[model samples]
Each structure stands twice: as structure tokens, then as C-alpha cells.
Target: MYAHAKEVAEGMLGEANVKIASQNMGGEDFAFYAQKAAGAMFWIGVGNQTTMERVRPLHSPHFVMDESALPIGAAFHASVAIEYLNKNQWCAA
Candidate 1:
């Protein structure tokens, strides 16, 4: 995961036209993809509910989140993106 993240960071950021935002110093989840797509937004996810509820979380013993939550999160991200673009005249740019 770290290697993949580093690869993305290097590939995307080495470009002069691509200005990188908050790297957040690690501890990121797969959620980073959604966040980065939304201008490096950062978020915390609990766990994958679709996965075996009987099984443990990615790291912790007690953490958990529903896969259903992902859609809601995506919606939130879209709304935020719209709001930001509207505020900054991004579309006009």
C-alpha cells in the first residue's frame, strides 16, 4: 500500500502542472483515492461492512464500517466538489 501510494504521489506530483495538496503524512486508507480525486480531501473510514462481519478490521480489532456507507460518502464528496467549484468559479476557469 505504501509503495503504491508513493508511486502515485511521485507520478502525479512530479509533474509541474499538477500541484499536490495535503499528503497528510501517511495513515491513509483506500479512501485516499476518493479524497485525492476531490482535491486531496482527507477522511476516516471505520471498516468494510461488506466483508465478513465476523472478521477483524484492516488493522484494529473493533473497527468497522458498512460498504453501504461508501455511496453516502461519494455523494458527500460530490456535493462538496460542487460547492467548491461554484465558490471558486472553477468551471469558468
Candidate 2:
């Protein structure tokens, strides 16, 4: 899926306008995802600043972030939600 998204993005927009960001996978969350079906998952609450910081170090105890990255995360999540809704034929109930 990531590869396909990258290909489409690059085809539609120049490489300069496309940024590919993939999260580092695997952690305690791996166990959670394994036990459930594809869609069932969990949410962790970390400050957006903290998330941006910790994400970079990959592994560390004292992680922090600036608040400014919130909008990007929100937009990314919104895009994902819309994709899922369309793919699964979901509607508000």
C-alpha cells in the first residue's frame, strides 16, 4: 500500500511536492494488532509535540515535540479516515 501510494503521488505530483512518511513499526502495539482483526486497534494519547519528537529519535525515554505539527497529523488522520470510510462503505450511524 505504501509503495502504491508513493507511486501514485509521484505520478500525479512532482517528487518535490510529495513527501513519504512511514512510522516505525513494531512495539507493544504489535501484540495488540495481532490479536484483533484488521480494523480493531488502540489509540495512545501523547502530545503532538511529544509525538513529533519521539518519532525522530526512534527509541528514547525523554521525548518531546513542538505543538506546530498537530495540523499535519490531523490532516493525515482525516485522509486515512476518509479512505477507510470509502473502502469499507461505512456511513454515520
lDDT of 2 by residue, 1-93 (tens): 344344444554457756544455656655575566443232222345434534544255665555465675465455555665566685678
Per-residue lDDT of 62 in model 2? 65
lDDT of 1 by residue, 1-93 (tens): 333333343453344533334655756575767666634433434355457565454566765556765775575456555655565574434
Tell me the TM-score of model 2. 0.42
Model 2: weakest 10-residue lDDT segment is 37-46
Candidate 2: stretches off by over 4 Å: 1-26, 39-61, 90-93
C-alpha displacement of 5 in model 2, angstroms?
A: 7.8
The lDDT leader among the candidates is: 1
lDDT for 57 in candidate 2 is 47
How much does candidate 1 score in TM-score?
0.37
Error of 2 at 19 (Å): 6.8
